[model samples]
Target chain A: MIKKVVASVQEAVQDIFDGSTIMVGGFGGSGLPEALICALRDHGARNLTIVANNVGGVQYGVGILIANRQVRKVICSFPIGRRQAKLQDTFWEQYRAGALEVELVPQGTLAERIRAGGAGIAAFYTPTGAGTGAAQAREVRSFGGRECLLELALKADFALVKAHKADRMGNLVYRKAMRNFNIMMATAANVTIAEVYEVVEAGTLGAELITTPGIYVDRVVEVKVERRWQG
Target chain B: MQATESVADSRLTERQIAWKVARVLEEGWYVNLGIGIPLHIVNYIPDDREVILHSENGILGMGTRPPVGEEDPDLVNAGKEPVTLRPGGCFFSQADSFAMVRGGHIDVAVMGALQVSERGDLANWMIPGHELGNIGGAMDLAAGARQVWVAMEHCTKDGKPKILKHCTYPLTAPDCVKMIFTDIAVIQITDAAPLLLETAPGWNPQDVQKLTEPKLLFTKPVKVMDLTGAPANK
Candidate 1:
């Protein structure tokens, strides 16, 4: 009957292996697949390469992964957060100890690269970091008198994303600004696992409202998490 | 005007400088406010004008902070601080949100700068020797927005000029800034040079010039900043 639902978070992340490139979706604390991340943490896949907006605050999503020493490298816009520095966060400590590798891209370029990866395009030129340090050691081209930097597409072994709702066939819908990187990451991964608030019948989700079509998603798991910000 | 007594004394408070920048925003404009001083600009936007706020994470028409306990972790601004959405607000994916920026749909991008060049260069995201700092959306906003306005203190806390002949820090974007609002003066970057547009009360062109590294140009007479507690439209 085209059921993609997984029984447990552990089962959803069981296939992940060491040295996998994982895209963990969230901007700040929003849209984080917390239970899935915790499951991955317990599953203990080592030397992971993570791509996301931030490393997450010290005790939060990606931070826990980094704290557990599961991540070897990160490609993100903001790896070292200002507030996290005050508390001597996990990323800062590992980064200072030269244990972690970072590839920082401009935020827009990061988003576009993931988008390109999903669409099967090789690479694109963007003016986001054209004349700055980000453009250093990269090819630059001019179009209509504006210089642009060439940014390559990024694909991951798996994408862990959070969504508001999902169907048995794995069609996904996101809520608010929480939609951030989840939509793009879902498309750019070899296997996309979505942790959603609810999983409904295949015909229940409106066709027009589906942000990620069932074709891209491989598994769906319902995970109800207490909102972390309220405390 | 003495150096020690005058420059520090005449400098506007951070809130006052934000109010001055907020007063200048046009109606029906889409503005992106960077973290720190630029975030304060929202509190002082004129009541008569309806300026749409853009948060880079994935929201347009960003509104004020939600009251305690009503906060939604799902909704946040570029700074990762929880925020509420305005009536006409909408959300999109990260790619679509940045498209609004890089597509030139954003009108003004207000940012805080560590250093600025007379030719409208900006350097804010990273330090010279530091291996990593948060780039975030600063570069895209600087290059993509129609106008880039910088809000910052005129000098460093140690009494060094931030407006420089050449920026020592790494450039965020070249030739992007259009105007600068500082504690002591409002400098407008023109095709020719940076011009002295306005100064704080009790300060003059010469006094402001002393603290600034680059030579100030006088294309026209400078006026005292209006800070009578009335909104700009009124």
Candidate 2:
């Protein structure tokens, strides 16, 4: 059995290299792996491709990386700031200058693509982008008399996630609707790192309550109080 | 406008009610049709009118349903069911899609209804016994739309009345429904009360009252129209 628990998020993501693709799990403001992200910023890794639901809110969460210019490209479903007009100007300026590479994915397809990556599927066809700009560069196949666009699988070099609780062996429990993308992306990366609010002894977490099993997790970090952005 | 006559007009069948409701749709309206019974509205949209459909999953300018054997697994609506897009359609992130909804870009939102109260309060997302999934973007759509409409059967499958004095299920939007299109009648919900506008063919206002749990307010006499030959189901 692999030992997964660590003392801090900094230790969990210690080996991530520059230019690596990383998956950060969260939905809107909930269930974000903040400790791991803060550690990534502290490491100052650059030219990274990030896959996430949102780029976090302004002044906190994923915005920290954006503020530091550590992220080169972002693949996300939404990019909203907590305070409107705060980051819009900066984002627009960077986007217009082509300084930042951004690719927006449909929420459902994004979730499925990550899930497919974990499941070892190369690509899947769907009708979501049959006649839109989103279908550019993708192969279109007609299935069952309907046109479907092919979407490739998305995998990351590292996966960072936040869970409500976990055992020393890394079995995770998510709080309510916060489970979102963490469960699927946990298995879609080469190194899966998890930050938990509470860590218990191995076998303490019931099998039925574990949303993500220990088999997929490589490192576990325990975090104290979660910091919030006042803005 | 008498109570007895008004109640008589409110008890039509689902198909019959859908056809009558279709006439109110204007051309070139940006509309978001919710899952379930509201989806049936697509079958009744007028061919002459260009209705741009927006899905919360990030597709705008959607077309009629695709043909069999051509279903695309990736091409789905907000409900995660397969869908087809119209010419000149665009796809974006769920964030942008919601920006369209929350920014007041959508003109109308037609949703399925489990319970509609006399006060026009709507409770459609969850019931007491069902397991609730993500609210997705329904709450935002319902709260942000310029107008909210509901389409549902007159009564539940178990013969329980859905039109109530007040909704008991978890609410998707509070007092957001402007008009309710039911198998029995088309009731326009105003700030004051729900007024009976039209009734199903053959069903009297009395028949409607018997099936409805709430006391419906009638402002004027209602007429029943032929709702057959609405748009073909896609």
Candidate 3:
């Protein structure tokens, strides 16, 4: 049997080094790998780059890493809402001070970049950021009357994803919108570690239900952490 | 440009502005309402129209908030607040959701703005000097939607106009806004020019132009946005 199970979340992420780029999957707290994130924070890897929808709030989800000052960069959509208007006051303190770098991508562009990395596409043009500051750099081309900018693919060294269920062989299934960025992140990373609620035998997860194939997953760690609900 | 509000009542609250935005929604349109003022639109939508609401976080056909005790922890809009999904509504990945947005499947996107130029430049994502900024999916929606509409206050709380000759902030998208629904007026953008189409109840075209820096063209007679359910004329 090709073994993919890891003894613990720590062991699963044991190889991550400082400055390693990580793609964490989730929208807000739902479907986040809480155990893996907490483990990463405990693992004490500094200067990490996080790619997600956002870091989430202070008391929940990836905010722990942000609050701990472990993150060096974030490539995200909205890092904070309008309520965090006092920007220098929150996790953004480092960003404003230039200690942390933020490469903000439009949500669609971010998703497509990750998907492109997994699919082996080197670059593509998108109209999302055209004619705006987001389109400031690189190449701009006109396609059928609409101008678009070329966006490159993005890949990560490790991807932490959450799943509702998984099989020992690593086939995975996600629940609801929580699967937000997990499916692509799983394939876009060199080492995809899945934190799942339940694990079954290799064939237990029906072929129809599996959203991600095990071949893309390098490790499977079963976790008992319930999905975080921001609401 | 197609339709202007016929109602003459002005003291348009956030809810009232939403009621006017709702009037523009045609039945069977798949709409995405941005946070802030745009969210109020769900409350005033006419009951007869069947509109499906889409959220960037991967929900479609999402309804208004469930009653207090009925909120579902896992069910929420992209904004992270509890929302109710109508029957036949489904959830997907954020990638898939943005594909729908970027792929041009969404019909309308109603959002707020910090600055909108006469040329339809949108600058909602950031204000200069802000510590943190996130553009999110608004750019995608602005670029990909069949039509993009802006609902915003006519002026800032400090009495500065939001509609200007040129946007002073970072742009979200260029030449994308089709219609602007403001508290004091409804202005249509035609060939990068603002057409003063309607005035609110108590305000006139002069009241709107005084605060608005851009040269306003009084194209076509002005009317008022319908505010049927608005708080009884303030």
Candidate 4:
């Protein structure tokens, strides 16, 4: 069986280059791979293409990455901030200055492209952006006798994910809904890094309980408790 | 009735009302339970049923509230409260979840209301004083669900009527509600209009009328019904 080598979070993310496309798994503040994020922040990578469910809270998760000025483009469904007013101000500032390249995808379409990338499919058709602003970069097609928007798969150079548990062989288990973006992202990256809370023995995790198997994972890091923070 | 008198009403206590609402859910029902008082419904779902709970941020197959110690930073409902996932539950794009909602796949949507008009119009996502009142998926859920139900108090905190002749706030759904269950009575909306199906025990139709601002169209005389076992008044 293939095994995942355990290393420190910094070492795991040390190879990431500036202007790389990276997929970070988490929804809002939940299940975000904080260890890898902090490592990237410390690594001082800039002009990054980041994909996530939402920008993490102002001082946590993706927000930290944003604050560090590491992100060049963001593909997401919602804007970031504690309140709508704050979110609006931040968005307006970024947009007016042309500093942020924001691609606003319907929450479902964004998820599907990530899933399709993981599934090894190049592209899929959807009705989600048929007539919306999201149609700008995509090709249109007709499927099943209806007009559908064709979106390309979104794979990245690096994917950082967090899971509740994992074995040396890399089979991962996520707790509850925290599993959101981690499983799909594992297959969608050239180099997938997982920061797991617990690294158990291989085969220790029951077959039914395994969420993302080791075949998709390339690196493993045992996250230190000191870096994890609650929102 | 004396204005100062506290009357024994027949509506289920909040806990009982939540339980009663949960009991009616069937397997595979795509549900959107509104925030506030309606959030309590999640606790009452039977373990055997395969109901898939949906939040606007795009999670499905959501489980009951997690134990206190196990709160994960990542798992949250549309209200931004941490939540648990049932067995076999998987996470997908929130956009896809809304697609399921907008595509008319959801079976039922239960929501809470500040006020509901006699015409079955719903006004729940906002109140005038609130600075931020984003409707989120409420509009889509109301329009897409085959059935829509509103659960709320019969009267406002200051004894003002919530069931109105017309809503004062912006509308969330246009004539979409099927039933309105309050602490005082259960009213059903039909072709003829808002029909008074049942009255709270000890309160007469006249009493309910005085509190309701809308001119109720009651085709038949209202009868009192047993309150579903909600948590007993604390």
Scored by DockQ, the top model is 1
Cα lDDT tens digits for candidate 1, B18-121:
89988989899999999988887778887788999999888988987888888898998888888889888899998998899999999999999999999999
B17, model 1: CA deviation in Å?
A: 2.0
Tens digit per residue, CA lDDT, model 2, B1-234: 234655434355455455555668788789898876666566667778788888765678866667776655435664444567788777554445656775688999888788888877777655677422224455666666788888888788898888888887766666678988887677888777677777766666777777787666764577664555643323
TM-scores for every predicted model: 0.95, 0.54, 0.91, 0.66
**Candidate 2 stretches greater than 4 Å from native:** A81-84, A226-231, B1-234
Order of all candidates by TM-score, from best down to worst? Answer: 1, 3, 4, 2
Evaluate residue A160 in candidate 1 and report its C-alpha lDDT on the 0 to 100 scale: 97
* Predicted complex 1: DockQ: 0.81
- Evaluation by TM-score, superior candidate among 2 and 3: 3
**Candidate No. with top TM-score:** 1
lDDT over C-alpha atoms for residue A95 of model 2: 61
Which ranking of candidates, highest lDDT first?
1, 3, 4, 2
- Candidate 3: fnat, from 0 to 1? 0.73
- lDDT by residue (B120-226, candidate 3, tens digit) is 88889988987557788889999988889999988898989999889999899998898999888999988846999998766778888898989888855678655
User: What is the model-wide C-alpha lDDT for candidate 3?
Assistant: 0.84
Which model, 1 or 2, shows the larger lDDT? 1
True contacts kept of 2: 0.00
Which lDDT value does model 4 have at A135?
54
The C-alpha stretches of model 3 lying farther than 4 A from their native spots are A82-93, A200-204, A226-231, B1-10, B231-234
TM-score, model 3 to reference: 0.91
